[model samples]
Target: MRRLLLLPLALVTLTLMTATTSAAEKDARVYEMRVYYAPPGKLDALNARFKNHTLKMFEKHGLTNVGYFVPVDNKENKLVYFISAPSKAARDKALQAMGGDADWKKAVADSEKDGKLVSKIESRFLTVTEYSPLLKVEKGAEERVFELRTYTATKGNLGHLNDRFKNHTIALFAKHGMTNLIYWNVLAGEKGADDTLIYLLAHKSKEAAAKSFDAFRKDPDWLAARKASEEKGGGSLTAEKNGVVSEFLVPTDYSPLK
Candidate 1:
């Protein structure tokens, strides 16, 4: 009689666990990366709009603000940020809602009254790579300097590059004191789907970043893995020149995913 009762309880527990797992899967978020190219002298105005009104308006439409950044080099007047929604369908619906919001429309008009702030906007949908460390919002994460790196793979070699990172490079990065935040690939962009990898890393400071990279480059394990992959894969996975772009950034005060 006791065994019969215990069997029912165990089945109930299993059913509940299955339901929770399904809910968690349904709640997984889709990330969007956006880059705004501010016109020659309008970067400050653009930033002001986001800082003052745009972000709040985004929240009103159910888009969760992730992080905001500006390139340290500043060659182009640009702003980059991330946001997430429950799913691609949800993301599209929320963005449409935000666009139709009266307050957001007014904010855009007011902010651009002087002139149009942005000239071009580039957007990409991304999914975290299978091996990527899940990003979390943590206290004191704001103090770290972030690096956004985009790599363009050599023609037909992206698979090789991904394998190297999946099997070796990611571990080497951790060994060198670099914090790997997330790795993603462009899902919808001008960049070829099979040839691009974009990722973010964090470091304690600029000096520490330089030191960490120096050590990473010299690590014997990394060197061996890189050489073997290049030889087996026909060549280096990345282009020989101008294939990698690295930008240093800092999180905005109100960024939720610091």
Candidate 2:
């Protein structure tokens, strides 16, 4: 299996799910989930079904999606996917609703009109840390976004990543209009809380996103600082375990910034 290396910076065209609630939480969370697949050759039919029938069902149901992610270099052994939800309770509500939605049932039936989508699909939920600031984004944010950057780390490297982020990149991004959130270590995927770091930047639109990176990448002082920290950490900028870079977009149902 080839490693998923490069990060994505495009608008993903998918999102869904909804629920009834009385009070909103103090801090909304960007609940993250990873769905793994069976195998490529065997999954063709299932894949077709998702593109055709199931994707619409999810939209029709109660889950409000932010975006979907495909590992940069997916081979077969391991596969990864992403979704965004407002809160854990909301997520639970959506999942419970799934158990009862007729559209989803029909979508599943029509797709598996042949067979199941996968032999097994496992998923985990995540909470966005308050400090990163992703949950605060309102619906209008889609109109202005920045980068969707992910930093992957192994067991010993999280401390290093944290230091790098706090001391430099975080500030640079903020200065450059890179908003819409912070860092997340894999909390519920394969390695759960031990394998990865994930986060997205919703900048002031794609053009601004391009300019922000250009300025950051071109600054010699910034480059030197990054290099110096890397040396002190005894390695490179990121730990690169499952170094995956993914892309995503907002859906109408759950966007907060409108």
Candidate 3:
């Protein structure tokens, strides 16, 4: 992760900076991150085959998972996995290699030949927006944490999600140690015209993040704020009401998202 602050005057500042910097620096690899939550009832079995057993097989074949995190707030039925890639080209190279790797081929055949653990997995591919920046992460740190969340507002609910977040969620996230990287509203590559909102959260480390979130969750003020919002119009999410289905993303390569 790298650190980038998006200021009110960000456009002016960024344009001036980019104008001054050479082209080579502009192409430095920026990973587009995604996070997904597993559906309920079948997650345990799914993890055995995918996250744990299959992911190890992935690492053997070069698909390195960056990390995993779950939502402290939304805990319906979800487990998250983070994926990484150096560059788009490198991402493709790795996947191509994985496809040809005997281990991956065998694992896929043995595990999924019958059928996938879950009927379908939700996915989102995000691109790093200019206004956002990934903070440089340090290894062997006391804590390493990342929060990958999506906003899936529909034709009407989009405004509410956007405005409410602009008015509240951003500051709340910032106040609670959730730093902004980049956010993608509707990055392409999903199966439909639109159905998801994508963003990333960078933390000092997972340990520090756990503690920070524990504090955030226990705060009386935060609870009250949320309760107050619910009193207004917070029931905007429903499978049929919104007519939206979304897949969270862990950043990967060879994507159509931009």
Candidate 4:
């Protein structure tokens, strides 16, 4: 009699666990990548606004602040950041509400009293790829260097590129001591939707990143995969000259994803 009762309880527990896992999978988060192009002399002001007011406003409206970064090379005076929501509809509603909040309005007006700090803003909505590892904020991740890589595929070749990564590149990266944090495709942006791949990687240090990549490039498996993909596709996946961009970043002290 006791064993019969215990069996029912165990089944109930398993059912609850399965339901929770299913819900999490169905509600997988959607991410937004935002870029603010600050005017030549106004980068500092823009950063100040975000540090002081914008991030708080975002939180109040139910957006999950991921991280904030500035490019190491500083080729353009830009601020980049990420945020997440439970779904695209939720993200849209939250942003609309944040836009109308009185506190946010006052903060924006006060920040621009001198002059408009940003010349333009660009936003991209992204959904994680099926093969992407779930993103997490590690307790000591602040000490790690993050690299954001963007790849532009040649016309009509994005699917092939993704296939290669899905089957080959990701494993090769792990073999070389690289951590694949997340992978995404641009849902909306100036760049065409079908041709872009963006992903983030974390490394212990800059030197470690270099060493890992150097090893990855020379691995026999990667070389064979690349050659076969190129041959099958009749050419390289990316455009000729400047098909890839990589930028190193450090998380801000207050960034939630660190």
Candidate 5:
């Protein structure tokens, strides 16, 4: 009789665990990052269309605008933006709906009357890391520069790279005055899923960002952690060439993040 009762309790616990895992999966959000290259003399027009029409249309179709930015020097005439959805399926559905909407069609037609504003576009899907801070922008926050950093792990060492960040690097970054904005993993089966870590950091200025990194590199704890991780992985976790890439960006005038 005791065994029968215990079996039922065990089943109940397993059921509850399954339900919790399902709920967590259901609530997970996916982020999309898109980069647009504007045609010569058309960058300002592209920005105007987004600021005036595209943003509102995105919200109308159920997409959440995360932020919009451009590089500090504007040499490439590129626009970078991020958006989020409850899931990839939801994001695709919303985009399809927006594409078919009459207003969106008209906006595109009107904006392109002179010429095509955008020359090319690149996109990637990302999911937040478990150790990342809640991705958000506080209302009325002061203006700041942002750094987008991408780390490419050496073959067979991506796990080690993630472990180092989860266990040591993030805290040390905070200790040196860098505001950890968000960390992301490229979705499975994507180009970089086997070996990439992408994250964003906010700083008071580009000069401040440089100084903060200088300090972080010299921190004894960081050096020790790097040594230990490399030893455990049997070599350097990151690739020897182009292992890390960084780009500094400034918020657009209409960006929510700034």
Candidate 6:
């Protein structure tokens, strides 16, 4: 009789655990990375609008601001930022509501009275990878330079590329003094969705980043993993030309992640 009762209790616990996990997955946020290109001298005005008006407006509508950044070199006058919502449907609803809000419209008009603040906008929706840390609202312990990396996998090799990272690369990164912040895959229906892996890493500085990568590349474990994975994937996993793109970014004053 005790065994029978134990079996039922065990089954009940298992059911509860599965249900909880499902709920957590359902509640996970989908993130959006947006890049706004400012027309020449308008970058300051664009940033001012975000600082003075837009961030609050976004919070009021249930959108969570992640971080805002500008390229370290600052050649293009681009503003890069992240935002997230509970789910894609919720994201659409919040954006629509914000778009229609009277105050939002007014703020946009006022900011752009002289000229349009942004000349071009590029947006991509990304889903967090299984190994990535859930982004928190808390800031880092120290000021850091963030590097955004975009990897384009060779045709039909994305799976193998992800396998390498999941099993070996992330650990080696930490061993070499690189802090892995978040990793993502572009959502289906988006350009590069099938071939792109985008992730962010925080470094002590550009010099630190360079030093870290140099060590990482020379690490025996990393070399073995890379060789094995490439062999399994049939040649290099990434495209031959521009396979990897890296950009160093500095956090804006109000960026939560910094």
Q: How much lDDT does each candidate structure score?
A: 0.77, 0.52, 0.48, 0.79, 0.82, 0.84
- Model 5: residues >4 Å from true position, as ranges? 1-27
Candidate 3 residue lDDT tens string, 1-258: 123224332343344334323332342442434334445555555556664455665566555455444444445545555455655566667778878878777766676654555544455444433333333332323333445655565444544454444444444455566555444454345332154555666677556566766877776655755565544545553125534333333221211111
> Each model's TM-score, in the order given?
0.83, 0.55, 0.46, 0.83, 0.88, 0.88
Using TM-score as the measure, the top candidate is 6
Give the better candidate number (3 or 6) by lDDT.
6
Model 2 spans with C-alpha error above 4 angstroms? 1-30, 34-97, 100-124, 188-192, 204-207, 240-258
lDDT, model 4, position 168: 73
lDDT string for model 1 (10-117, tens) is 353344334433443443577889999999989888888998998898888898888888877778998999988887788899989989989889999988888899
lDDT of 5 by residue, 155-258 (tens): 89988998887667766676677777788888787889889888889998999999999999998878999999999999999988999989999888888887
Q: Deviation in angstroms for 99 in model 1?
A: 1.2
Worst 10 residues of 6 by lDDT: 1-10
Q: Look at candidate 1 and tell me the lDDT of residue 195.
A: 86
Clash-forming residue pairs, model 5? none
Summed backbone clashes in each candidate are: 0, 20, 18, 0, 0, 0
What's model 4's lDDT at 13? 32
**Deviating ranges (above 4 Å) for candidate 1:** 1-28, 139-142, 188-191
For 160-236, candidate 2 gives per-residue lDDT tens digits of: 66565545555555444455354555544335465456676666655667787788777675687678877876776
- Candidate maximizing lDDT: 6
